[model samples]
Target: MNMGTRTDSRFMHLADIVKVNLELEQDWTGLAVHKSSPRGDGDCDGQKLLRPLLSGLPPKRLYIHPDDQIDMIKNLTGPGESETEWVLPLHQSENPTTISMLASLFDSLPNPPVPSRRKRIILASVHNDSTVVYYIVHDGLVKPRQN
Candidate 1:
């Protein structure tokens, strides 16, 4: 099998793991996550290949490289836009996503966040036992919730 196939399979597997967890543990009744096609150039997964969460939210780009060095720019949809363009990055569950990586992602965003709106990405890390944990990474510091 070629490298592209391997990456596709990995993404598909991750997506499946995520879906199962969402249904069984998270109580996501009608959740659906789609795996994107590979770019076919043997490049690491990024915005080019996305796995969107549900139907309303934008698809998240999958990144599995040990090093979080992304060169793609995130497309930020303007306010009032019906759909979110481009994609959000998702770190593989097993990978250690550092604060610097998160900062780079935020810096790569095409548009600045508007008041009352925050920019974030989903980091889906899968464990050795096939359990995946998803975290929402914000662009910058956010106010703690009172709950």
Candidate 2:
């Protein structure tokens, strides 16, 4: 098989893993797998290296801004609602190079409908045995939430 074919197959497999992990395991709703334009030749600086990203709404709010949390606590209000979040699914083997690539692609993503101070995504790392781990990534430094 050619390189293109192999890449395509691998992408599809990763997409499936993301879908199952989000929908079935995590019980997230409105899951969508966004197709990237194309893969590039190890050029992390270029747009061609963009990878597929998944977006969806989780059952509960996965993140709350520090300021927002303070306000909610002061007013005795509950966590309002969950917002749509971006998810980037990558194989465990790809983690080393993914950090550099993430900056470029994160900037390329469309702004969220609800205006916010920062851009964030859920990084979903898929292991060889199908165990997917998730981490929250932000475009820039954000104040830590109060415990």
TM-score of each: 0.47, 0.81
Clashes of each: 3, 0
- Top-lDDT structure, candidate number: 2
**Global lDDT of each candidate:** 0.46, 0.77
lDDT of 2 at 76: 100
**Which ten contiguous residues of candidate 1 have the minimum total lDDT?**
64-73
Worst 10 residues of 2 by lDDT: 37-46
Tell me, what's the RMSD of every candidate? 11.7, 4.9
Expressed as tens digits, the lDDT of each residue in 5-121 for candidate 1 is 886666666666766765576554445553432223233334433333322233242222222122122333322333332233244544545677556544444443345456655
Q: What is the lDDT of residue 124 in candidate 2?
A: 84
| TM accuracy, model 1 | 0.47
